[model samples]
Target chain A: MIDSQKPASAQDAEHHRTKMQKRKAVQDKEVASKTVEKGLLIVNTGAGKGKSTAAFGLALRMLGYGRRVVVIQFIKGAWHTGERKALERFEDLVEWHALGEGFTWETQDKARDIAACQGAWRVAQQALANPDVGLVILDELNIALRYDYLPMEQVLADIAARPESQHVAVTGRNAKEAMLEAADLVTEMTLVKHHFKAGVKAQEGIEF
Target chain B: MIDSQKPASAQDAEHHRTKMQKRKAVQDKEVASKTVEKGLLIVNTGAGKGKSTAAFGLALRMLGYGRRVVVIQFIKGAWHTGERKALERFEDLVEWHALGEGFTWETQDKARDIAACQGAWRVAQQALANPDVGLVILDELNIALRYDYLPMEQVLADIAARPESQHVAVTGRNAKEAMLEAADLVTEMTLVKHHFKAGVKAQEGIEF
Candidate 1:
């Protein structure tokens, strides 16, 4: 009788252990699922067209969902056709700031353009600091960094420190490797095909 | 000589007549600062408080720079918290989608919620065709529209026709809208805020 009882007890203990292991596995899975987060970063680059346009589309998607968003246009100051006319309607929901005094060649003043870039950076810092802002798009920012108008290290640091829930996008040619690495999503817009190279200048209401 | 003088005078008159008019008032002010176009609609409605928090802070500001944006919040989505967030980040780039959905008890039932709303006619139609879709935030859409599973005529039409540049957002008390909205940016979070309400609860990150 003692031997039989011992065997039965041992079997019960083993069953309990198996049950505990299964429970633990389920709990671990639940935690993992809960911790999963969704965030996005879009990069539009290369010698192509529609970089800013793509960024703008993403920005609108986020906004329509009631996500707070910020956009900083780099190396573009002249009243371009699109932003000035079409984008201003949402004056209450959008903010537009021009950073370039004009392209470097047009102005022939690197120092002035750099100063303007610094001012834009200050604004970007403020936007990044805000926790409520969901998406921040740096339009043509890569060009500014390539030109050395904005400090690349500082920009990278700021992006790294942004609120975890926030999404940041950088658009322009030659996006820095650091920026690409920091991004949750990176898309390079290659010049597979474009109409402008055919000498068809940008038309109003279309390119703008 | 007289005949030659007459012809020259006529030529001068034509030239002067064609010259552009100069104004005493330099109307250099951007007459139409930005183009007014249809925008996406984002709705955030649920038992959670982060719907608008995520919407205004993350999406609206992104649209402010160059993307056309519009926001319409049903109910009292216009509390000081949301207002403060918008003021600080967007700089007047967002519009209030106000309808005073009122308290649940005051106007309860599917028929009433559906009746109160004119459908997503105007906003949805615009978002579908507009190309500069930066962001659209529809704060608290689920509770209002889901009371009856409201006919998705306007909503579906807009989504179907939405330009590549447009995106839509919807948030509210129940996830029924999520199913209906077919969101490109969807987030459903389990609640963690439990302190201040303590049974009769309403707190900052959890209730606002």
Candidate 2:
């Protein structure tokens, strides 16, 4: 009935339409089946860039909904990152705390690093307890956990005790297995290629 | 000299400091070697979420530096996404064009899909040609390329011919081999676990 009288292109279009129609029905059913709603514990990890970037993106999204966002940087100083500057524009909705001086190699003091992590964890606990906050971004928390700067059990306990409707995003490379197990969503940004190998320096607004 | 007559913790600390000093020297030299500067063709792909989200985050970073950003959404409609609404706050610095009405299954007309892709590609070419635009995001461009709605050769050619200092981020799943080859940086987001299978619906300000 369809392909007999139609031109080649028309026949192809009709065939495609039929196939798509079947797919749409299946997709619609699957989508309708998902009914549960809960705050998500999101983990972004791996060797590639954008784990923190994507977390900031989620922070921006929460701000779009007129929700409060708390950002606690665990392992790096808030040394003028473009995202930090941009998010700071939403003054009333954002609470940012950069707790560390720099990386472990730069600091080279285990005692100091542990103290800083403990300080950041205290701040994180307060944020988690606040039901008014919509999203809490614990940037580079995995690195602190990996180094055993803070007790992982206490961190997980605090996260579990957070408000039911509050979302949290934890980011860093080499996320712990227990952390991954606790997460509702986990994304690993795998590095396929890097421009640094080709002699490109980190540029402002591109990498920070 | 270092470990003699000292507490165990103090000796361990001294050893750590010495090791870190060596690592810092190596890091500083490697960083000093990279002096070249140029725009990058970045690709974000794979099955995990945040491909487009990361691109938008980069757009926000560019905006923080008071630079221009152009976003061309290849397949998704100009739906009420939180990121779009948030980015639209920077009216003067952002140019956003959401070309397609929806996905292939939703559209189902190859001709219409091709037309939409061509329209978006035209906009992309213009953005690529402009030196003022710091970053141009081709969101879901991989899907369009995978469907063969636009010629991969032409797409790559346009990107290559863009302004030297203009960065471009192409995002979507199943990126073409040629696209990956042409990119200066490539990040493949690998999905470890998603909440959707656990009956969790995509929440507003989280998924969108």
Candidate 3:
């Protein structure tokens, strides 16, 4: 009954199975013990590129379940993004506000950036208060926090006071330590390598 | 013309407008110079949890633009993922094949696992051959490669031979050096914190 050409041994497989069964038991028990249910404060930050993209994907997942979602853009409001165009088709399910003037470096004015961030925060607070919105994505909010465009204490307090059942996602680079500490889930995107450094130009559909 | 309560300075606003105009010109030039259009090999790897989620998000982005996409799950076929159920609404736009039996440790049979991976690779190769498929997501492929379930050289060769304009996303932990070398863009996810370690269980509609 031995298959000589296979990549793994039968004995190895059986041993793995036993080990996994035990692991599964532990995993199942661990998973079961997590009974706490509440809205999550998710932070996607670091030098990697998918923080905002991942947040947008979560938004899309929410929309798939027919839940209403609101996205308040803090920095990437200048260009038309693929996510924005795609979500527009789900007009009935998504409320998108591309509120920022543009990237901070492009604007080069701290005062204006802070003002734009504050403007977005007002709208986000309203989204947080609305029970109809199941998910609120504070896109690139971390950039504003990094630049002190909005007071960290106020942002933290506002997020903490969000509706019990409403989930919130914050994305950007160099997220504040306070924000990270308060997050239920924190994913740091590390840049192993980027195509931009290799002289590869950004494609419209892919980059934006 | 300066309002004390305004978020933006009138002068600053004008300066930003001029700056954006110049920046747009430069951006347009950079974009124009990037005329080479071809399929991209994107890799998401590391200890972070959003690798597959990010890849799925990329798939959703393609679906948003009305392009057909394919997702072939390698190590998570046993459980019913929220994404699999959610993608069902886009019946015509998506082709999701959860081909794995389960995690390798659970099955414990290396021969069987290798055969399963080989079978799935054949299916994936067909998906790659299809010109209409805009994106192909090889979910958890690194796991199969890690365990030597499938031949890595064959996998890389197949990916390289894919249609010129199609996009391929491979997600998992500990991706091989060859895979990373071949990838056009790579994002390494670093796990800063996970609820599982905090005794948090997986929740329905959230983790699944």
lDDT (10s digit) by residue, model 2, range A107-202:
899899999999999999999999999999999999999989999999999999999999999999999999999999999999999999999998
Report the Cα RMSD per candidate: 17.1, 1.4, 4.5
TM-score of each: 0.44, 0.97, 0.88
Per-prediction DockQ: 0.03, 0.75, 0.41
- Highest lDDT among the candidates is held by which one? 2
- lDDT: which is higher, 1 or 3? 3
Per-residue error (Å), model 2, residue A135 = 0.8
**In candidate 1, which residue ranges exceed 4 Å CA deviation?**
A1-35, B1-208
Ranking by lDDT: 2, 3, 1
Model 2, residue B187: distance off in Å is 0.4
Alpha-carbon runs more than 4 Å astray in model 2: A78-80, B1-4, B78-80
* Model 3 misplaced regions, further than 4 Å: A1-8, A108-110, B1-35
User: A40-69 in candidate 3: lDDT tens per residue?
Assistant: 888899988789888877776777677788
Error of 2 at B19 (Å): 2.1
Candidate 1: Cα lDDT at B30: 26
Give the per-residue lDDT digits (tens) of candidate 2, residues B1-208: 6657899999988988988888889988988988988889999999998888788888878888988999899998744378877876788988989897787889989899999999999999999999999999999999999989999999999999999999999999999999999999999999999999899887888887
lDDT of 1 by residue, B42-61 (tens): 33333423455545434433
Please report the candidate that would top DockQ against the real structure: 2
Residue B145 alpha-carbon offset, candidate 3, angstroms: 0.7
